[model samples]
Target: MSGVDLGVFARCFPAQAPEPLGRAIADAGFSSVQLNLSAIGLPTIPDAQALADIDLVAVRRDLEAPGLRIWGLSGSYNLAHPDQERAREQTEDAARLIRRAPELGVVAVTLCTGSRNPDDMWRAHPDNDTAEAWADLLRNLGPLFDAAEEADVFLAVEPEPGNVISGTDAAVRLLDELGERASRIGFILDPANLVGETGPDEYETVLRDAFDRLGSRAICVHAKDVVTWDERIAGAAGLDFDLVRALHAALPHPVPVVVQDADPANLAAVRALVLGDA
Candidate 1:
């Protein structure tokens, strides 16, 4: 599935609304899409209420494109939140997608474990390492995993650097906490998310090591690249096709390597790259 059927978020294109975005994604030559579930209507799915607001037209198009059904939702919630009420709200948002996952015809729900900053969903916080942080994460994610189990789908946790479970180690700990249910909850590998000085080349080791430990739980991948900077690597402004090529070469197949992160202007380029036309 890795790069075999490249799909991008229609919203990433930004030129059109939700419906056209799917068409653009299809035109890009991706056979499947890891839908930014939020783009469909729900901002974040942490429950069923958000699912009710989803736009069905986009789903129809994706189905019509004859695109292979991959991840049908992106419920990127910050599971490791500091405030209890805010955390529950986010989870409730994410859960909406989980409730409706079956209808989407996909089994996995991708999510960001979330950072501590309430105002900034993308920024990381220092308390993300404290025991209280861990407790909050466990409390939130434990139930999310429970919901996933009930939904009969897998929850793919993206290890974003700014989020709580930012690496393989953190992910492993979550798995240990959940035990057998961990099988239902897995990692959605994003190589560039770990970017720092050495970036993926450095984190490539992390990726491989993570694969060694959690290969079984690796449900999908986020095909992207990060730019190496002074003493650390940050997410690159542009896409890196080689990153997908390298990851595809290194990992086992059957799981999809979604062609994500394409901007609206270059979405076509991502399609070309994924389909081997580039």
Candidate 2:
């Protein structure tokens, strides 16, 4: 964890406004944050008026005042929605967020590879593994890549259990297919997302393989202690800290390992575990 910077998702502090949330995170001992636009009342796809109304200078000042760094913005949306119109809308929103990321002092934007489930992007669907699904995903990604290139920002895609790009191999394949455009794309490596309720030995093997395959391309890490496929906590889900350290070591450069999907009451415990105090 020497080179890893610990952070939390801004949405974790739902009780506080954006600026106060930054202060709360810093006071809680985190050094960085991944912002959710909705936390600040900005629509997922903000128009020119909304964008103009955002006081980036004040936002930056407020966050920095408490020693908090803005690592990335969460622009996660379903790229493989069953509804073509909805997918297009989400993609356009992603593009808008990417274009405006720099002005907000964000280095990257997190995204979901998406599922065929029209209702929930994080839910699994049988069609997620089909060739047609892959094609649809690629087609949708093209415009986002164009937007990333134009904005000069990195797009971090997380490979979840039920998404079209579910595991390490699929993620690597998607990256390869993108080819030159892959430079603007990066991975948000979440160990918990790649494993479920399994034996410690099998979990270790799968997690290690994931780092071996995609660690080099990761721009950020998500720290969550997953017990079951759907049950995730803040920290210490029986995963060895040594493996976490090794994963961080494998990265080409230091990046934020942000904690997510945990309850507000568990944030302190999560922070302690991430900082090696537990």
Q: Could you tell me every candidate's TM-score relative to the true structure? A: 0.81, 0.91
Off by over 4 Å in 2: 47-49, 196-199, 228-237
Go through the candidates in order and give each one's C-alpha lDDT: 0.64, 0.78
Residue 113 in candidate 1 has what lDDT?
73
Where does candidate 1 stray beyond 4 Å?
1-3, 15-19, 46-50, 53-70, 197-203, 228-246, 271-278
lDDT score of residue 1 within candidate 2? 63
Top-TM-score candidate index: 2
Model 2: how far residue 192 lies from native, Å: 0.4
Candidate 1 C-alpha lDDT tens digits along 1-278? 23354455434555434455566666666666776644554454524544565655456555445444545577776676667797887776666567667766676877777778876656788978778888887777766776787788888787777778877788888888877777777677776674433443465576567666766677776665563221112233433446455655656655666755566556555445544455
